[model samples]
Target: MAEKSGKAFDFRLFKRLISYTQPYRFTFYFVAFAAIMLSIFGVLRPYLLQQVIDKTIIPKDGGLLVYFISLMVGVLFLEVISQFLFIYFANWLGQQVILDLRIKLFRHMLGFKKQYYDKSAVGRLVTRAVSDIETIASIFSQGLFMIISDLLKMLVILGYMFYQSWQLTLLVLVILPLIVYATRVFQKKMKAAFEEVRTQVSNLNSFVQERITGMKIVQLFTREETEYTNFKEINEKHKKGWIKTVWYNSIFFPIAEMSSSVTIGLIVWFGGLKAAQGDVITLGVVVAFIELSQMLFRPLRQIADKFNTLQMGMVAANRVFAVLDTEAIIENKGAINLEKVRGDIDFDDVRFSYLEGEEVLKGISLSVKAGETVAIVGATGAGKSTIINLLSRFYEIDSGTISIDKTDIKTVSLPSLRSHIAVVLQDVFLFADTILNNITLNNPEITEEQVQAAAKEIGIHDFIMSLPEGYHYNVKERGVMLSSGQRQLISFLRAYVTNPGILVLDEATSSIDSHSEQLIQDATDKITKGRTSIVIAHRLATIKNADKIIVMDQGTIVEQGNHNELLKISDGYYRNLYEVQFAEV
Candidate 1:
């Protein structure tokens, strides 16, 4: 029942799906056998009725009648047992396959670089992981085995009917072509509708996710009505997609029913005429053919319904498999290891751009000695933040060598390289969990007491203690409950507790309260005293105590020195920056 061409099934997709069933091969094969048995049993009920009416009931054979009824009851029990086996194992297989597929998909996504995420929607990926895979489960539970079983049942029923009486079989068969034609058209049309429905659902999910995350901005700008209108458009498209499927169903199913009703009437009329004329057709045969015709036609309709489920499942498989097929991740080709870093860093002729030929970091070279504090001061888009991104290997550089100690960063494992460095950014993201878990991030080596000690050392212990639940406080989604200043303190504490060899503070105090700024400055002084620290700052006052100050302009380093040394030059970029900021005072 997997999606097919206009003429035949898509065996390639069928093979691919079957390949996944290899792990549970024994169970899959057993379920398939049970489905065959179920099909065989499906035709038995009509066959037994035909034999009973002809051989036992009409002949008045009481002994044979009791034996046949007992046998019929036994067949019913066998059919029931086969159905249970088919349903239970098929569903079990689907659930197991989805569990494995979801885990693989989530793990594959974790390895993808920042560029992949920049161009993709979170909700789209989530749909593939959750909803799309659920659709695939229908392949087993509704589509694959059930379609085969129904087809087999129809074949057996037709064989019995033709053997009993060909004239009546031919009468029923005349309307079969119409049902088949309608079904083919219905399958194709519904597939297109299902595709549109999936696309609209993904769009709706992505739209709602972004809007909910940024609801504060929408409310601040009084744009609720504008967003609502946009949401209505997306929702309407989704509704129209489903309506098209319903429209197709309304047209196709009634035609099928009419064809079935016509087939039954033809059998009754033709068999009646033939019986009156000669002994060619009997009452038992006429009666059995009627029941058999329902068996044949009802399955055709049921199969069309199941084919819709199969089509949707194939669409979902294509979407999920598309994500798995993407090769957009950084490969680990390096074996360099680091137990403890010496913190010597270098960027030699580093050139990088998020997009090709749109250079954000232009041939910039700089170095930080062991235990040195280098503060970078620049305007927005001056590549100050880009430097941090490259150092962390969040994005691959266009052309450059970023080295730590004597080893190039590209020659070292990502975990080893990043484990030694800690970064605190302006925008802090906190999980909707306890404060202690946020700080530790579930790192086993960093104990609760160690985090508490680090907080106290930075003079934030008293502030954290003032919270309603202290270290156990739940920060809510994205730390919405805490002020920006409080979140910044938590970030600082998180970085400090890591005891990293190198520390980075990027615009860390740019958007915080005065009290928080003072506390952060005091904390920054204590943390950067002996570590290799790189600070990207907008405020020139923050870098005055830095051992080295690198001034950037338009992706290039224009000046480099201590605060006093750079200020001595009258027209230097750092001096000019200092003048503009302090000129207000």
Candidate 2:
């Protein structure tokens, strides 16, 4: 999908982001006040030098000179104290805002439906949550403070310089338009460059994440050389991006320096002529003008540099807001709480497609009575898993109604509806936590005895107990620390622990060995004794005892009956699948 685009920075997004900082407005205001005072104090230092030259030293008044020098020291001390407090509070406020924003972003992302993850990249999400947030924090903590201080200091110095001598100030002001024009040109170029840099960085991050996640496959295929070349290309692109950024910065600084130099030279020549003529211009005033000239250009140069940084920050902000603004189409709108469901499932003419106009489930209707065990068997891509997904409301049907206990799933609150269903898919995912935790994942309140009972019922308790840490053994990512069969058993235990009214086993035994499959089947029979169960599998033997067998083909039901009835109809899809499995055996 093409990403949402607009101006480089969205004002509404910024407004929302700033709202988070409302709690720290007091601190920000105090910091700004301190910064203004410090700038005032800083401008006064050069004026004090001018005073010592004009009113004390030039007049041979050593006592007055000492007093002014002591006063300068006192002003310097005050500036230092103010700066310390400003930095302390600004840093504190920035960190707090970042912390709150990170947490809020995380919660929002978590609340998004699975389809959102299906469309978004993990690296891009991580970049927004971590890198982009840090960039914004820097802008808030350092950039905002510096901009205020520099602009205020420049304004004060310019006002005083013009007040003292309008002619010299006007000479400097003549180049103001040129400076602004140049800054705009540079800003535009830098913004474009930074946008490209941000894109390249995101690509590099995605590449690293992909390679790391598939490292085992890469090594197994002995494609290290090819992967290395790919990485080198991405790295080279990143290097070129940074080089372009540096090149722009390098050129901008020289232009600013040249502008400042020319302004100072003009003042020296013009101001000196006026002083020589005794044209109401003292040596003290001329010296102060020179100091003020430096002060003015210093901030102008700083502003140019900061503008570059701000442009980079704007690029990051654009990416961050893109994520924040994504609207979840499927969300609970009203309080339609489902309680004590009896697990009667109905799919009334359900039709769905991941992409528009390409239906994957077409006009399919099925009703599973309360506590009934239904097995759906189909060829690959025959909509068996899609039916399971629809029943769980993972994806909304394009056309039709799905309900549990007569209430349309859409009308029910998602959390409450999903809380009563337990699903175990072919590919089990286990966190890097203890074995006990993985088994009791759905029920953190489950006791140790309950965990042990569930494991024993699944016939995996002996194997678990053999480990050094027993139930406490850590399951690595995807349960790599355990065998495939052991992982499948743990998944079964997890589902059983939930005590769900509706159980879904989507190829649950497909990953296990025949012996483990038998154990899981035995446990499944026990678990489904009182709960409604929907088993989607390719193995016909596994569902021989199902109360009903549904055979589907190309998103539609082709045949459905009891095991004996399907066998009697030799042309039925279920009988053919049974023959194929028997032939393999």
Candidate 3:
């Protein structure tokens, strides 16, 4: 699912992620300064400890001991303060970076053409916009900032160790190569493991999201046992991926700890022998070296773990940048900004295909004059919906042009073009919000009074008032609390409130009961009056009074006439289709 990229660390991605901190550069610099202060204060503690042991305890000088102890305590207090500032500011900086990143990524996704979403999983995108971004924050909080602090602390400890006695420092270096090699190997393996873990997490999220959304289908088919088994398989894979990283940590940490112990043992053995020989090495010096050795090895060990953190953040960054790098966005290059549209539409030799070499809309042509209602009747897969999609520029046409009021729609700004159109589909979606908010979509320009007026004009004001809270009623997620027909009515109100120049009803009455259909039909009549309307007719009876009924076969129009004229052709496709529907009724 997730592929490992070049190197355990990606400098390009790291640099790009760092650029987000430009807005908070002062905080970033402050954290770096804190890291330096922490290192300097850390070195001061052991030196003070050596002074207390040699200059006070050895000579029984209590006053000198008090002075050194106070200094040591002071350094410890400052070190704590530095540590606090480093943690608080680093986390603050990280939260700010991911906040901007998530917003930019979401805005980018919003501009992507429908074609891009046609092949994308909602769950995978959710992971990118939410959880994956959370992981990238660790790059600042635990990855880069901590690594720099630990490395600086280690270097400072190393310099002081050499200053005390270069020979012992050389001895400490003996076990270092082994630790470094182990850390290097651990980093490589952990990077791959973390990438796989992220991939599995995305897969698990996608599977769960889809299954939950379609739980009705799973139960309807009595497939709970089968689906549970599938879930278990996916979950088992996720667990195994994480356990592999755990296995690496299990092996690596203990080895580094044992290495640290061995170095400590070597220090005590060498320093003890030198003391017995009356060399410069003394009791205070040996004890201080012991403290310094632990200080050095601890960070070296932690650096390995923090490097994995860095690696994981890099992996997540790569995934997020991949989404940001996509060229699937609909470019708003059109200079035209039409404030109002007369709604005269034309499709001149329009050809389109959802997939290459498999055209869904053949080179077809159609027109609808301003304030006219035209009905397109076709069987499923006959490209009736494709025509609507193209008209709205949901998918680009491969050849030819679609025009609104004789102006090419491609030359009109997207917001200006789409603002003039409203669509009501068979499967209507409503947000988990109050009915008024859902209808108005939280547009401040359209107030509660306007929504009430639109509802009354569409003949659904009484229906809404009959509800427990009227327009204030909350329609839960996707309007599940409401019936299919009720949701469709809400969608109608949503569309009508916008006062669009063009109205589209794409099989809007296909699955509703007779009573709801009557309500929708009444609403439809009111909304479409004097508006250029396109109706994709599922029931042939619904379009009997349509101004123009264009019958489609495959992807091309087979008949174009009013009901009486089409019925006059006894052997025509429309006549036969109408007769079949009449028989079914």
Candidate 4:
């Protein structure tokens, strides 16, 4: 979920956002310059109006009137151009910053350890990377730049008003405290409401993404009505979150409008009294004061709303910064050498746990020589998969070292280590792409011809050719267009194309029918040739031909030997499991 910090105007967060603009520093500074120019133009316009009424129109100076009016029109043209630059450049800077931020955020996520994603939801991460960053863009679009321009306008208006008549200025100052108090209250309440709104949005996204991904389970169990009911509950929370922000907006804007009107009334009543008494305050002076007051306080009223945008951006920045700040990769702080591996793997007394005090692998020591096919067999939760996970360094071991070719795995760079190994999981994930693209995965080095050659070597090239578009076939999202067996064969060719030194097939045949399983088995045998392979499977027949078999019970290996050697001990866990799967063998 998106976490919110308490500070509404976090300078630390503001600085972090500003730092991203370094690449486009000139554009950012130019936008600021535009804002300043807008203030200058805005403040001068009202003063020119006062001049027109008192100097040109009053003394019947028809000849001078045209010149002064022309000057005012020229000023108006420049103001329009300045406004155009402000709006256009401000939004341009915002778009550019978000483009870089989204790219940086994604690159950061790619380096994180698997553990970070294991406990995270796709929807929450998507919300942060997508929508929250959009909200952050408002920091420039409707927030930081506009706020600076408006505040400057307010300052200039007040400066000229004080110079005109100090008495009316004093009267205006009397109601200033009340408006300030109301704005402060509005901002505080709005900050909390906005934070809640962001949180509910993340929750709603998480729920919908997960439910949709696993819609198979929901439909299989006939839970559509029930799931929809649950979704309505989450949706209600999301609606209420927005309603709270709207409720605060409803209460505050009208108060600001009312205060602006009251200030105008006070200015008119007081200036009229002064004119009747024959003071130096003229009609032009009173009208100019009124105009100046509106300029001063109109921005004052809009400042609270813009500040709401600022607070939301800061809150989103805090969330985004938290992800960037996490040092969760368990980084490879050792050598970064891409050495040619012989695939002689050794696990020496390795122990690990996904959570505290719940060890998954308990001091398991095992070794596999180069080019040997090893199989690990275990019941559910027997820590069979953990061995491969630790070997791959997906999860760091708590107490031992896993080494390949006599070098500690942790000492090697992750890309250098993972590049030499290929994993084919039970659920083969294929992208929404053509068969050739999925096989090559857009790697220029692995060409279409190379993929065709590898598929032929693995004996599934004929299967691909049998399809309507032979190699150019579009396997829709998650390879739903292909059968389970076809996807497994594609996974085989994918791994084989890389020519990895080590191959890991985790339950690759678990979900296949007997026919597809046989095809996968043949493909697996061809691909694993001359490579160090570790196979985890429930089918006892698949590992019967392996050089060695490791049987795990809980978190430790209970038996290790060939099929006949293990079957000789009828009382062992291996024999018990083998007998149930291959009773006819």
Please write out the lDDT profile of model 1 over residues 1-585, one tens digit for every residue: 333244335567767877888999999999989988987898888888877987899898999999889989999999999999999999999888888888888999998888899999998998999999999999989998889889988898888888988888899999999999999989888888888888898999889989999999999999999999999999999999999999999999999999999999998899888777767688778888898999999999999999999888888887888898888877767698788987899999999988998999999999999889999988899999999988988889999899999789999998888899999998999999888999999899999899899998889899988999999999999998899999999999999998888999999999999899988999999888888999999988888999999999899999999999999998888888899999976
Which is the winner by TM-score between candidate 2 and candidate 4? Answer: 4
* Per-model lDDT: 0.90, 0.83, 0.90, 0.87
- The estimated TM-scores of all candidates read 0.96, 0.94, 0.98, 0.97
Tell me the tens digit of each residue's lDDT in model 3 across 411-462. 9889888889999998898999999999999989999999998888777899
Clashing pairs in 3: none
TM-score of 2: 0.94
Poorly placed runs, candidate 1 (over 4 Å) = 1-10, 277-280
Q: What is the lDDT of residue 422 in candidate 4?
A: 90
Two-way TM-score contest, 2 vs 3, winner: 3
Assess candidate 3 and give its TM-score to the true structure: 0.98
Q: What lDDT tens digits, residue by residue, belong to model 4 across residues 161-186?
A: 88988998888888888888998888
After superposing all C-alphas onto the true structure, candidate 1 shows an RMSD in angstroms of 2.3
- The predictions' CA RMSDs to the true structure, in order, are 2.3, 2.3, 1.4, 1.7
Q: How many angstroms is residue 168 displaced in model 3 relative to the true structure, after the best TM-score fit? A: 0.4
